[model samples]
Target chain A: HVTEAVHEYSIAHSTPLPEVVEQHRARSIDFANRVGMDPGMMVNTLQAQFMLFLAKLIGAKKVLEVGTFTGYSALAWAEAIKGQEGAKLVCCDIPGPHTEFAKATLLEAGFLNKLVTFFEGDGVETLQSLPVDQFDIIFLDANKDGYLPALKTILSRNLLSARGIVVADNALKQGLVADATDKNPHAANSNPGGVMGYEHIDEFNKFVRDNEQLEQVLLPAFDGLNIIRLKQ
Target chain B: HVTEAVHEYSIAHSTPLPEVVEQHRARSIDFANRVGMDPGMMVNTLQAQFMLFLAKLIGAKKVLEVGTFTGYSALAWAEAIKGQEGAKLVCCDIPGPHTEFAKATLLEAGFLNKLVTFFEGDGVETLQSLPVDQFDIIFLDANKDGYLPALKTILSRNLLSARGIVVADNALKQGLVADATDKNPHAANSNPGGVMGYEHIDEFNKFVRDNEQLEQVLLPAFDGLNIIRLKQ
Candidate 1:
């Protein structure tokens, strides 16, 4: 009953998103509509702000993003690292309308490949082929099914910098991951375009929970964000 | 319709709270019943975890707390600083049942009076009497109206370590702060309880938003938490 009001309360109280980010978000939303994709995939403004603050709070210099949808989140990360002359963000996403839109929006955000280097391939393959430089922050937002594999790959390959943080967006899929009964339409493949083909997101959620090398907490806000701190 | 589901999803996905913290939380709820007060003032486990990660992320060696309701949050901070033998947490709260409950819980957590030093009296006066020291983190969970004044005190006093963070619980005030309209029941005076006396929390939210020395984000989840990073 009071749920929506409570959610809106926090959003209204937050410092509004920067003009640059909001503009990029608008462009992404427009592009998503044109391409008939879910605009919800775009990083919400508060999430963008949180990620930006976190990156700066830790002095993150190198950022790796698995999903570059419209580049909203990457742009946010770039904003945080702007003062550093050499800070870089390596983004990986498949060649598609989403990334194409991301290219256009990144340009609009005044970063247009400046601090960002967009890879043109699947996240797993792109990450595997890259030179081994440690990443201070590694964000996972692509293909929900790949969360576990992507995380395992990130850790097993020593891609995270010392004291690095790994953030996974949409760790909870509309509460379906928590309670995937017949009542939860999101758990069904036919509902809402098989978002990530309705993979067992719960499994990925569990791996992060049980991993010995990681200490994690899921910020149960905004589609369920999983914030994991690498103990190593 | 999906709002509650989303919130629950995140909470469910989170790593469950340990027995020590849970025991404290349970005790607080029970104590709140005895005191005829709202139990929601206790920091939720997810928020607790986030605070712990943040403190450790900045390698916090000193923490300051403005409210010590049963000492739940202080314990959370202590858990984060477990290995840092010299780390200290200074807490200020009035002498009352809450502080008494906190003392008992702290002892029950196997950390009675360890790493934590409680100051009894008014928050403002208590803070004023303390020696000026840069804290890696300063948390506010006191009177609602105290948000701005407390923040001003913390900032003017330079009470934050370099890369320090200031966190205020209930920055959202049940969504009423965002829109103090008569139609919004939570915005009305006859609501659950005025944790901070509903002292225009939106204004406090706005001050944090507008302040230059502070870069802040109001997380709309979990009753609206505002996290501010001191730029200096």
Candidate 2:
């Protein structure tokens, strides 16, 4: 568990995200609020920073994101691979106002065509449609229930490279995946989404942990981040 | 903050460390207890897991560790880079029973000369005497006050590869670096080491943040792990 002071300090000391990415995040939150949607769908700033660090750490040139909520994370990924040769980011999200906004925002950020490819459709279908190539990084943050299915597709199709990593967000779902009882404050919240998604997330976690072909580390930081890789 | 249930659940779902490494960790704790040393000086299992993931993420071949307390972390590093060609782990620590214990342990683990090279002396001095070759990863976990100087030397001597990362453990020192007041329980602990190292860690954090040449993310997990790199 992290205290507010400690959290603030950690963020302050972390590398600042690009101004464009920050603007996109703020705009996404505003849009979500205006549309009566939970802005929590977007990755937080610290998570964004960590993802950027990860992308660069692996010298990621090919990235795939199963979810592209308002393109904030896509922009961060674009920033990470901007100058690299032949770097590409593929994002999939169901068609809607969110997808439209993401397209517009990323175009404005100069990443739409140059670096990112947006697919408006079901996540698994989109994964199936992609060319048979290995992605250095694959990020899963879409519908909770779709996580395990998407992962199965990714692995069966060999979309993840030999040395690549898969980063799954909300794997813990506010710790509800681990503890769905009344003790978890999130369980008593007005929104039952956390409790509802508990079964799906827990299933995904267990599947990843038990799958002999994969290895993962579930971090308690944030909503529980799962960094997974194929066993070497 | 994280609850105990969440923490335990997270670890349970994460990948397990190698049996040898786990045995070494347990032995290290027993040795520390017998010698009246704080076993906490060694990294926790979760941190070791994270480091292993990090090394594999970056495909690290050359690693430098400024601290070698009982060789627990060094052993983990050796495991991470084991099969890679020319993989090498260089460790620096003061001459003492700890170093001797570490040597014997690593030798028994079949990594002494095979993958690790141990140095005995002041951390900074040992770092200065090393060759000018770049290391893919450099870990700082020695004397708190020596962090800044060691970093400066590392940079000045071009010891870190272009895309390399420097992971500094205990960068937050039980949150005292952020809030060194009675409000922080660590401030009142019998071990003044946290309080004593407060300024140094704080200074190091600020220096890393302010340096235009370096970018860092200080994670709040596990007493604060700072992942730093040169600006692109």
Candidate 3:
């Protein structure tokens, strides 16, 4: 029940995507189609605007994105950081043709700088292996259930810089993350797994809310986004 | 249309509103109900978290709000500015019992001080009359159609500081701003006035996009928010 027409209109009213962004997004979609994978992993382009906006808001010089599915979001951060000298973006995803495809897209976008590092392994492993402990922003968009562990590791490792923020995508998991009942439209129409798929996001959301060092805002837009700013 | 249950669950996961915020919101709702006016003018509480998050992200010290409805948004801006020494928030709205109610809420929140000022007059006039030449942020939640004039006034007054932002609420106008067709759910079910109500927002959204002096992103979240960052 996304009400497709209204959503289409919302996207239309916002800033239209740049040619590079649109090209990269289309490349990812075509790759997903060929691989028989879910294109839903590619975030909506409207959300790309939100990320770009957030990056500027924080004056982020460095951004880390877990889940570099074809690099749509990675390119977004890169675009956001453009004109900032020595800015960097690190993306982590398992080594695969898809990962290589994303790299190619980044290259095509002309954002393939000396600083854009790709970790070709488990996102968590990459997270642990990063040489730097400070990132202005860490974006979690990998496996949904892995978020809790990632959160714990980020906190334990003290990976975020002062005033840094952590953004978790799909925190709503198609509204099923909130309304777990079978009667909900997303739950009834597609989520045959009941609430199992979104349990981790639910846990992560609560952890963000309950944590003393973090202040969280769960935005109910496009599958939900958790904007968690560290109080420390 | 908001799918109240899922939305409530989403809000439940976000940071819980403070007692003062909750009290003001409740009071506003009660007054709206009593008067048979739409309390829908009041923003959803979840957006309060976003506002607070943005305020901190920018380290905002001075905020200018063009619409001070029962003061929910004004109080939100006030709460966001807390702990910053000498931070100020100026609100503009027509004089009425609603504005009076908002004043009382600010008084109760203990945020009324030399820093907080209220302008009881037309929003644009107040904008032109402001003594300050700059602010960290300017928020527009006033009359929907007045946004163009308000934008002109803010820019002519040079009210926004460097790297400052302008957030206009209801930029989507319940999706009608995006889609005005009878096929759209909101337009068909609720809006009998065609797209007349949101013409200003529609124009403003386009103006933000087409204008070279600003870079804009229209976030299709809680009633839609237009984040306009001054390029100058």
Candidate 4:
């Protein structure tokens, strides 16, 4: 429950994102506009700042990102682990212009080979090939339907470290997951390609809640963020 | 902004709080009603769950709480560091019925003296007496006016560990700290007992934001929560 004024106030009070990451975010937005893609695909600046805070709070060294759109978020994560020895970020995304843009942007930011590696292929396949129990943080920001499968693979295969956390973006889909009815204005655009988008996210939310192995908190901020950790 | 349905949906999907903690929370509400105290002094269930997640995420071992209204939030921290070796939670509050209730409740929960210690004095004095660079997490929920002083003492005295964080509850004061005008309904109640509540909170927010030694993110959930860390 945030008003526009309060949201702006919060952002103004928060630590500003690094200038290089901000530059990448701007370029990503421009690229999305030029290519007629949804700019909302990228996390907002505040969300990025929150993720950075989380990464450093847990001292995350190895991070796995399911979607690396133009490397905006990868840049944020890179900033989080900038000076840590042996820190590495592995990003997986589909092969397309988005990957190309991400590679170039990250390279220009001087973190390409130094801190980040890209696996340009299917998300699930890339996750399957990674070493188990290595990633201290796994960020899920890909397709809605893939959220569940990716989480399942991560847990079943032990892809997350002993103290790792999995953060899933767009878990609520503009509150559609909670109420996808006519009463909600956003519900009108809740579905595309004849598939109910909220259903997939709702299923993911329910699965996370019911799974005895996981404990989660669904933050009702910035579309929705699910912070999950393996029960000790 | 969040609607009632979405807020409910979020709570339902989040990991449930422990049954003992829930019982404590219920008793806290009852105590507040019986004594004509505001139940809002205690944190809601969702906020407590978030704190638990944060504590575990950072593997907090030593916690310092500036407020312990009936020991509700302290119990949450205790659960977070349950089985860890040498874990301790120090709670400071003015001696009164609140302290007695907190002692009884925490003792009933098997945390009094075993895991939590009560200082029973002024918040600032209590903070000043804490060991330097020891506390992994410091919870600030005491008097609104004392927030800045308490934070200053914690910083100047190095009460927070190198990787530790300071969490301030009610940082926004029901959005009044951002907009304390007639346009906001909460503004009228913003001033009580010849003191302006929002101004104190706003001052604390600005001080935290302007301090070069600290980085913070203000989450617009549950009144408002400020997550802060020392600049490395």
- Candidate 4, superposed: residue stretches over 4 Å from native: A131-133, A192-196, B130-133, B192-196
Q: Pick the candidate with the highest DockQ.
A: 4
What's the DockQ of model 4? Answer: 0.60
* Candidate 1 per-residue lDDT over residues A164-221, each given as its tens digit: 8888888776676655666777656434235474344677777877777887777776
lDDT of 4 by residue, A1-232 (tens): 3377788898899999999988888888999888877777888888888899889888899999998888889999999998899899999899888889899888888888888888898788888787664789999988778888899899889888889999999887888877777888987776733323778888999999999999999987788899999988
| lDDT (Cα, 0-100) at B175 in candidate 4 | 87
- How would the candidate models be sorted by lDDT, starting from the highest? 2, 4, 3, 1
Q: What TM-score would every model get versus the actual structure?
A: 0.89, 0.94, 0.92, 0.95
Q: Which 10 consecutive positions of candidate 1 chain B have the poorest summed lDDT?
A: B190-199
Clash pairs for candidate 1: A220-B10, B70-B102, B144-B196
| Per-residue lDDT over B114-206 for candidate 3, one digit per residue giving the tens place of the 0 to 100 score | 557888998888887779667888999887767888898888778888878989888887777656676656765653333336767778888
Displacement of residue B158 (Cα, Å) in model 1 is 1.0
**Candidate 3, after superposition: displacement of residue B226 in Å?**
1.2
Query: Candidate 3 lDDT, tens digit per residue, A46-68?
Result: 88877877788778988889999
Tens-digit lDDT track for model 2 on B18-111?
8888999889989989988888899888888889888887889999999898999998899899898989999999988889999999899888
lDDT of each: 0.76, 0.87, 0.79, 0.86
**TM-score of model 1 vs. true structure:** 0.89
How accurately is candidate 3 docked according to DockQ?
Answer: 0.56
DockQ of 1: 0.48
Sort by TM-score, best first: 4, 2, 3, 1
C-alpha RMSD in Å of predicted model 1 compared with the true structure: 3.1
Worst ten in a row by lDDT for model 2 chain A: A189-198
